[model samples]
Target: MSRHLIYLSILTSLTACAGNSRPAVQQDTTSAITGTDTLNRMVLVPGGTFSMGADDSTGMPDEYPKHSVKVDSFWMDEHEVTNREFAAFVAATGYVTTAEKPISKEELMATLPPGSAEPDSSMLAAGALVFTPPNHAVPFNDVSQWWSFIAGASWQHPEGPGSDIKGRENHPVTQVSWHDAQTYAKWAGKRLPTEAEWEYAARGGLSNQIYPWGSEALTAGKPKANTWNGNFPYKNTHTDGFENTAPVKSYNPNGYQLYDMSGNVWEWVSDLYDARYYAQVENGAANPSGPAKGYDPEDPALEKHVIRGGSYMCSDEYCRGYRVSARMKTTPESGLANLGFRCVRSVTHH
Candidate 1:
C-alpha cells in the first residue's frame, strides 16, 4: 500500500463527523480575551530567530531544508488541552465533533478508487479511527493491522461505545479533527499554533536539540514522555508508566514550562501541510505561516494539516515524531485516538 493511504487508513475513522458543548476559560488580560483558558494555564513564549526543520538527516523528508525563521512572542497553553477543558467548550457551545456526524455518500466515494463499488449505507455511519494493537507482531507497511474505524468513537468515547473519559479527564482530548480544534480555539478566543510557532515553542530555547527537553535519548535515562517502549502494535513495555495517553502534567515541562511538547498526543497546528514547504521558506524569513495550500503528491485529493508532538504510539523504530523538528500531516476532517491539540494566542494589545 502507498504511504499516505497506509496512514490514511489507520488515522481515519471508518466515516463521519458530529457534537460538542461549552464552558468558559479566560481569566486574565484585562478581561479582553474572554472565553479562553486562564493565562495561568499558559506560558509566554519569548520569540526569536532559530533554525526550523531538521538540523541533520535524522528527520523525515518533510522536515528537510532546515532553515532559519523568526516568530513573535505569544501565549501558549502549558499543556495539551485536557478532556475537562474540551468538555467545557462543548458544554457551553453544544457543538458537535467530526467523529459524531455521519459521512455523506459523496464524501465516502471520493476516498475510494475509481471504478470502485459504492459502500453500503451502514458502512457510512458516524465513527472515528482508533488504535487497536494486535496480539502478535505485524508488518508496518499495512497499518490496517492495528487500526480500525469504530462506530460511535467520538472524543467522549475514544475507543468506542464501552470506553469513556471518566478517569481521563485530565488527559488530552482525542478524536478531535483539525476543524474541531479550530472551532474550540475560536470559541476560546485563541487559535492553533502555526507550524513555525509550534516548532519554535517546542524547541524551548534550545536550537538543534533532538527532543523538547534536550538531546538525551528517551531510553537513555529517567522516563521522559508517554510513548511506545516495546515492539509497536504488538508489545509495549509501559516503560513510561502509561499504556496510552498520560495526564497533561504527568511528565516534566520543557524549558518554557510547556508540557507534553514531545509526546502524549499529536497537536493540530494552523499551517497547511505541504511536503515541500520547508524548501520554499528562505533560510532567514520571518514568521512564515506555512504553505498557502497543502499539496501531498501521494494523496492529492485530501487536504492535510500539520500535526506536531508525536503520540503514545510513537517509537524509535516506527517514528521519532517527538524530535524537535519532526513533522507529520493528516486531513482536517479526520480524527484519531492519539491526536489532539493546544492553542496559542497572539499577545493581547491591551
Candidate 2:
C-alpha cells in the first residue's frame, strides 16, 4: 500500500467532545457584518489578537516558536459539516467528491518513487481509506498494519460497500478530502477557515489554555469529549459512549458556542502545512494566512494541508491532539472516516 493510503486507513480508524451550557459568545455589533448562512448555523467570531501555536514542553516542533497573530472577525460554523448539510450542496451542484473520482495513472505516479514500475490500472480505482484496527498491538511506525484502501469506499459509503449513512444525517460527514471541502464551501458561499482563524475561534476567547475547556484533564467527573478511554486500536473503553464518530453537538460547546472543536473528528483548515511557519512569523502578523507553499520533512514529495482539533482516537496515552494547539497534516486528497471540516465566511464591510 502507498503511504498515502496507509495514512488514510489508520487515521480513519482513529475516528471517533465537552461541557455545561456556557453563555453564547457575544458577537460584536459595532462592526456587525450583514447576511447569514442560515443553512450552516454560523456563529459570529469576534475579531481579536491571540498567541498562535504552542510551547515546547507540550507541543510538537511544528507547533513551536509560538507566535502572536491577529485575525479579523468572521462567521464560522458552530459544528462540523453534517451529512444532511453536505447532501444539500451535492443535490444542488451535482458535485462529486475526490474520493468518488477514479485516480489516474499520472496522479498515482506523481506520488511514487521515480523509475518505479506502474501497477495494473485496476489498482487505481475510486476509493477512500477505511480504518481496520488490528486485533493485536503493533508497532506504530508501520501504519499499514491496520489501514487499507477500499476501492468502493466514498463519502456515501463510509465503511466501503456495505456501510451507509442511513440514519446518520445529524452526524458529521467524513471521508471528505480537502478539495472536497473547498467544493462544498464554494457551493455554500463560504470557505475553510485559515489555520489562524480556526485556532483563534477554537480558543473561544481563552488564551494559553490546553483543551477547549481549559482543562488538560481529559476527564473530570464526566468525560469531556468522545476520545478513546483505553489502549488505542487494541482497546477502546468507549467511556464517552462512542467508539466512532458521534453526532454533532453530542457534547457541550466551547466558550465560543462551537461544538466538537477539540474532538469527534479532525477538521481541515485552509492553511498549507509548513513546519517552519511559526518561526517565520515570530514578530506577530495581522490576519496571517499560512505559508504560501507547503512543506513537510516526513514526505517532501507530497504537499500537505493543516488539519486541527484532533479526533476520537486522540488520548492521553497516544495522540494528545485533543489539545487546542495541536497540529496535523495530510495530503489534500487523503480523506478518512475521522476527518471532516466546517466552513467560515469573512465579515464583509459595507
Candidate 3:
C-alpha cells in the first residue's frame, strides 16, 4: 500500500479511537518497542580502527585531513530517544528542560532590536526555533528566513503552546539541549556518547562509507531515510515517507542495528564544541574529550557543544550534514525543532 494510504488509515483509526480511550499512551508504548530491544535501546558497538574525518573532495573544509582513530567498545542508543521515553524521564524525575525556563528580560532585549515593541512575556519566554514554511525560496545559509522562535516550544509542547505530543509520542523529542539530554541520560543510568563513540556507532561497522547504508545514493528504487526530496524550504514531496521526522524505527536500521543515525534529528554528544579537536587527538588509544573549553565563532555568548547527524531539514541546498562525518555545534542552552538526542552506556560483560 502507498505510504499516504497507510498514514490515512492510521490517522483514521486514531481519530476514531481518540474519544473512547487513551490511544496515545497505548500506541506510544507499542510503537516505542516495535523493533528489537537492541534497536530500541543501546547496543554494544564493538570498537575498532576506522578513518575518523572526511577525505572526500565533496566534503566540507572543516571535515578535512581525514585520519585514522581507534575507539574502545561502547554501548550506544540504537535509536534517538523518543518523546514517550523522555516524558517518562520527566515524569519520574520532575526535570525541567533548559528551554522550559523563562528567558531573562536582559537576555531577551539583547537579541531584539532597539525600538522594537515591548517584548511580551510570551515572546521573552525561552522556546525552540520551529521551522515555518517560507513563501519563497531563501538562501539556505540564512536560517532566520525559515526558522522562527516559537514561544513555549519545549519537548512537551513541541510546536509551541496548545501543541501536545498527542500521537507523536513515538517520534524523537526535539527542543532538548545538551544539558537536558545529559540530565535524562543520568536519570536513565546512561551518558551521552563521546564524539568518537558516536561516529563509531554511526559508521555501523562499515569502513569509511559516506552514509550509514554505504556509498549508495540516499534512494535508489525506494526512499532510504527521512530527508528533503523536493525543492527544499518550498515544497517537500515527502517521498521518503515523511516531510518531517517519522516515528522511531520508521526507517531501516544500519548494520549495527541503529536507526535514524543519519537524519531525523541531530543528536547531542558529550564532547565540547571544537572544530579542530579531531586534528589534535593522539593517533593511539586515548579517550579524547574534545577541547578544554567550548567555543563557536558564530555565537560565542554561550558555551557550545557538539551535535552529530544532520536533521530532517538538512538538504544539499542548505545543511548537507547527513553524512557520518558531518558535525555541527549549538549552545548548550539552545534547542530547536530539529535538535534531540540519544543516550549511551559503557559496555561491560556481566
Candidate 4:
C-alpha cells in the first residue's frame, strides 16, 4: 500500500484480523512434503453452504447485503503462520521479502495518482508499516498518527532496527506483503484461502454469529483473542493477556477446532477486495474467488486484496475487525506490523 494509501483501511478504518492450531512448533516438514504428519497441524474444513457477510454493527459496508456461498472442503492451517514456520521457508528459499527491497521512484509513482507529486528518494527506502502508539489517547480520524513506515522494519526485525524476533518464534510473522505470502505458499505447495473459504471456515460451521465462539462479547468470557482492551493506537490495557501478537493457541479454539481465528493479526486471503462484491456475487455461488477486479472507493489508485480478522489494535470504539464477517483491505504491498497469513490445500491434493 502506498504510505499515503496505507490500510489507513481509511485507520485499516480501525475494523481490521484469525486461524487455529496446536502449540506452534517449527514442525519437521519440508516444502515438498504434504504427508499426514503435516496434515495433523491443519484442520479439514468441511464443504458447506452458509450466509456470507454480515449486516451487524461490527460489519463494514462491504460486509452488507449478506449473500450465500458454498465452498468445498479444504485443509487449513490451524493458526497464522508463526515466525518459526516463516523462518523455515526463508531459510530454505532464502526469500527476500518485499519490505526488505527498496521501493524505487517509479514504483512509488505508479502507486500515486496521476497528478501526485514524486516522493523524495529517501522515502523509498525498504520498510514496512509499524505501529507507534502515542503516550495518550487521541482523535480517531487519522490513522497515520499511530502507524509509521519504518525503515529497516521487516518480518525479521518487526519493530525496526533494534528489535528482532529472537524469542518470538512461535508468534505470528508480521510485516509480510501479499506477494511474500504467495511466494511462501508456493514454496510450501499450498495456497492462500479465498474470501469465501476463509469466512466459511472462520464461521466454524456457525451462522450469523459475530465471533467464532458466538455472539458473546470478548470481555464477557475469559479473554478470547488479543485485541486492544482500552484506548487504541495509544494505550492497550492488555486485558487479553497480550500487548502484541500472542503465541499461537494462546486462546481457546473455535468450533472447528481452530484457534486464534478472530484476533492476533490480520490475515491475507486469495480474493480481490471489491467493496460491493457481496451484492454482486450470485447467491449460493459455489467456491467463489471474489471479484474479477479490485475496487476501493477510498483508495482507487491501486488494487487491494481482502484481509480478514482484526489485529491487536482492534477495539470496540475503533476497529471491531475481530467479528467473523468483518473485512478489511489493503494494497498487495501493504504489509504491516499487525498483518500475517496462513495457507490451505485442496482436499483432492494428496
- Could you tally the backbone clashes for each prediction? 28, 5, 0, 11
User: Candidate 2 on 1-350: residue-level lDDT in tens?
Assistant: 24344455334323311133333565434323223244347788888888887733778877887778888999888899988888877887799988888877777687577998996766678888777877788766555655678887888998899999989888889999999999888767789999999998888877787878875587777777878778876788788999889988999888988899988989999999897888886466899888999887766655788899988877776687888889888878776878899998888823
Q: What 10-residue stretch in candidate 2 is worst by lDDT?
A: 12-21
TM-score of each: 0.90, 0.89, 0.83, 0.90
Q: Write the per-residue lDDT of candidate 1 for residues 153-218, one digit (tens) a residue.
A: 999999999999999989999999988999999988888999999998888888788888878889
Clashes of 4: 11
User: Scored by CA lDDT, what does every candidate get?
Assistant: 0.80, 0.79, 0.71, 0.81
Residue 326 displacement in candidate 4 (angstroms):
0.2
TM-score of 1: 0.90
Q: Candidate 2 or 4, higher lDDT?
A: 4
Q: With candidate 2 superimposed using the best TM-score fit, by how many Å does residue 245's alpha carbon deviate from the native?
A: 0.3
lDDT of 4 at 265: 96
* Per-residue lDDT of candidate 4, residues 1-350 (tens digit): 45534545534434232123222222333344443225337777888888888837556778888888889988788889889889888988899998898877886787677998879877788888889988887777667778877898999999899999999988999999999999988887789999989888888877788898888888796998888888777777788789999998899877777778898999999999988898899998999998999987866655788889888888888888888888888888776899999888887875
Range of the 10 consecutive residues with the lowest summed lDDT in candidate 1:
14-23
Model 3: lDDT to the true structure = 0.71
- The predicted structure with the larger lDDT, 1 or 2, is 1
Per-residue alpha-carbon lDDT of candidate 3 for residues 302-347, written as tens digits (9 for 90 to 100) = 4567788888877766566778888777666776788798887665
Q: What TM-score should be assigned to candidate 3? A: 0.83
- By how many angstroms RMSD does model 2 differ from the true structure? 4.2
